[model samples]
Target: MDLHIVDLIESLNNFDENPSARLSNSIIISDYPGLISYLIQNLSGINIKILRQLLEYIPEQILEEILINETLPSKLIEHIKTQPPDYDSIKILSDIYDESIYEQLVDSEVLSKLVYSIQGAGPKMCENLVKVLVFISKHKMQEILSIPNSRNFGEILIYRLNRAQGIEKKLMLKTVTDIIFSFPDYFYINDLKVVCDIVVDSLSNQEEEILTENYEALTALMDVKDFFDLKYRFSEIYEVLQVPEGNSYILKIQDRIYSMISN
Candidate 1:
């Protein structure tokens, strides 16, 4: 074994022996740039549990530096692929603002794994996975749209939308909105219509926050170039907003849609 590897392992072991020593250990690691580099470079050899612990104490700026390592993004994807979803790792990856990490993710075909993992995921995992998807869609829309299975991925998003609720559903809606705005041509007519239907259906939701998201999602859909052809799909919106006295909030949303389509 390399002497440096042996020394790192020993030091990690010592940190494990005294859990409360994390503050001092993090300080020592941060003061030595070489040690931080060595740790990041040899991440594959280190135990995940230990790495997760060490990450907690690392300063945010230093952690951002560590995240920029080209290998780290791929490694995080591989870890999610080979093991059950690691919320911490996924959350970290989602928080990464580096375009290089997103490029690595695109090259690795991380989308399919992320979508597949959404099934049967707990709330936190689902939130992180969707956040990552949203991030990729925002930064690498063209690459994602060019993938052969991109349409299938869209279908999965719609399917999940049908089954999701509350915040998950809202996030899913935002992700779908982002993709549609970026690649309106990619979705078939029926897909576009279904998205319209989903948004209109969500208007009945009583939660004020969800109702607001539904309104925003609806307005976003109307902005899609393709949505004009499918505007009839939202014919039901008029019926939904109709009231004896007319609720002010619902009326406002109705007015916005009418104003958007008329312009």
Candidate 2:
């Protein structure tokens, strides 16, 4: 037992559960190969309470790193499914987007049902669906739509979009749009134009940091032109941004948007 390893465990300060105790038991495991197997044997009680307890003690950053670095054990995952996940707990999980953890969670017959179990979850469920949808394979698209949850997901997405800005915000909106298209039934489908207009208007007010990164995304939303108006707006934007001479990718896209639909 290295003294520094002991220190890290002791530094945890207020840990008071079996899972916390078990995780503490692994203080030296990171340095020792095969010790996790032994530690797993010692940890007979890895229930949701225990797992959440571990989540509480570990910094979310470290938990994210661990989830990415290792395979989530099936037993541990099944436990996460048994209890309704705490909102904060789910928030933590959603922050880290590891492909493998996604695979494991989607495989849970229990979680698979719960992912779309929007009735009880309400607004929170919509956010959860958006988070999970990013990692969904194409085959699962139908199953996701079948969840019967109302389009509360759209509101959750809009909420996040309102908060995010620049490239970060643009990527989030693009992800939402992708999810929206995949589960188009969740929304009126016709309502996409409103969403597009909202996003474009947002870009209209933003600093160039966002416009440079999101010009194309905003313009592509024009593909569904029945509801959105882009020609005048894109023209105004191109003139304001000065089109950068022959390298005007934004201008070209705007031109394409114009050709796609007239007034």
Candidate 3:
């Protein structure tokens, strides 16, 4: 016998909880494409939010269909958006963080849109996006950066490296930029200078990660001609590193630069 979505509507309506109703309704919708398609065509007849929440996953076509459902009441539609920002905006810092960064984590779909936004957006836009990604983690950050057009993720990050001002986030930026270099076509001259500068500066800060990352950056820079220019621009940095209060790590870098450029 051909099944029907409406036939299960009565039972679906009987449940107050989301999970059971979702499981039951899924069984019905999957059983009858014709009736499900017909109900989808007449979306005004049911609560799209509940339908969306009940579905195991929202298909792109189905979401597109739902978006076009103009007959969906504004109040009910607003309720669908009742979900709040993932972070409490009341506790946010105006200068240190971006408001849009908090919106990126609403769900995976929002996060995906955010990653795409970073690709085409300018440095400021990518700045907030990277902050959000790092707030998430190296693994989640990789997921966003791995998507096509994600090479630009480093652009904002490198911009941060140059402007970073002896703060914890600034210090952490060394590792973040290093991660960005993993991209096949990234690590441009401007980016390299900013990263190398941060790496060298970390010598005073005495961060082992910074020293290690700087070595790798120098190795990477050996291949790029503009790296020689970066050395000239950063000439004063080696002098600071050479003073050696308690930082042989940084002094070592100064010696290496002297050796490389002197020869």
Candidate 4:
């Protein structure tokens, strides 16, 4: 039988909470083309969870189709930048694979709005938002970093990194790593110096996960030849790791960086 999304949507509206999941499942399992665009264009004030569920059903080609519209990026960004930043919807959106849509994201000031949302978010919600930002950077680092406010982008991320704790802090460090390595030419030397400082502090975290991530990030930053120009900071970083009888893992990180810088 031929299926229509509007009919499915109406069926969804008529159902009470109990059966909605079943109906949503039916729609998703079908994987019809144009379904995602239909939802975006026709739906208004839809619950973000429902929207995410629907978006998750969409294949990547359909997602690219939805973004082909000039207006959709701004609409999607506005939807994501809601009062708390919609984590589920943004998460689904972040998986977008098309490179062309990233230009539209920059035009919509997605980076600026994400930074604003990060400023006030409590820890739980902040991790979700940071994940969305990280995914965007993962996919579109060069395009997003090329924009004029990209330094502000780096600074905002660093500011968050400075105050973040637990898992959120690890996510921020990974985002910083992506930024530092992906667009070294986009950020100024001074901005990188600040990032190096943050990575140095992160390396001192006792958790092995954070330590491993910071070590990898620090290595990437140092691999950039310009980072070596700031040679004076190396001893300070080494000394920070030298807190008498630190973890053996931390010592290994120190030894690795020492090996690199010594050569």
Ranking the candidates on lDDT from highest down gives: 1, 4, 2, 3
Regions of candidate 2 where Cα sits further than 4 Å from its true position: 1-65, 68-76, 108-114, 117-129, 137-142, 166-168, 179-186, 189-194, 207-213, 225-249, 260-262
Candidate achieving higher lDDT, 3 or 4: 4
Best by TM-score: 2
Which ten contiguous residues of candidate 4 have the minimum total lDDT? 53-62
Q: Summarize candidate 1's per-residue lDDT along 6-76 as a digit string, tens digits.
A: 56556665565335455354445334345455555655534444445455554453565566566666676
Q: Compute the lDDT of residue 101 as modeled in candidate 4.
A: 64
lDDT of each: 0.63, 0.49, 0.48, 0.61
- Candidate 3 residue-wise lDDT, 57-147, digit = tens: 4343243443344333332222323532212111111122223443343445544555565655655445555665555444455566656
Of 2 and 4, the candidate ranking higher by lDDT? 4
Per the 3 Å backbone cut-off, how many clashing residue pairs does candidate 3 have?
0
TM-scores of the candidates are: 0.52, 0.59, 0.43, 0.50
TM-score of 2: 0.59
Q: Least lDDT summed over 10 consecutive residues: which range in candidate 3?
A: 85-94
Cα shift from native, residue 7, model 4 (Å): 24
Tens digit of lDDT per residue, candidate 2, span 150-227?
A: 254455555656666555576666655565545443444345555555556665665555554455555545544433
lDDT of 4 by residue, 83-117 (tens): 44555555555555344665455444566666565
Off by over 4 Å in 3: 1-111, 119-126, 140-142, 168-172, 180-185, 194-240
Best by lDDT: 1
**lDDT minimum window of 10 residues, candidate 1:** 23-32
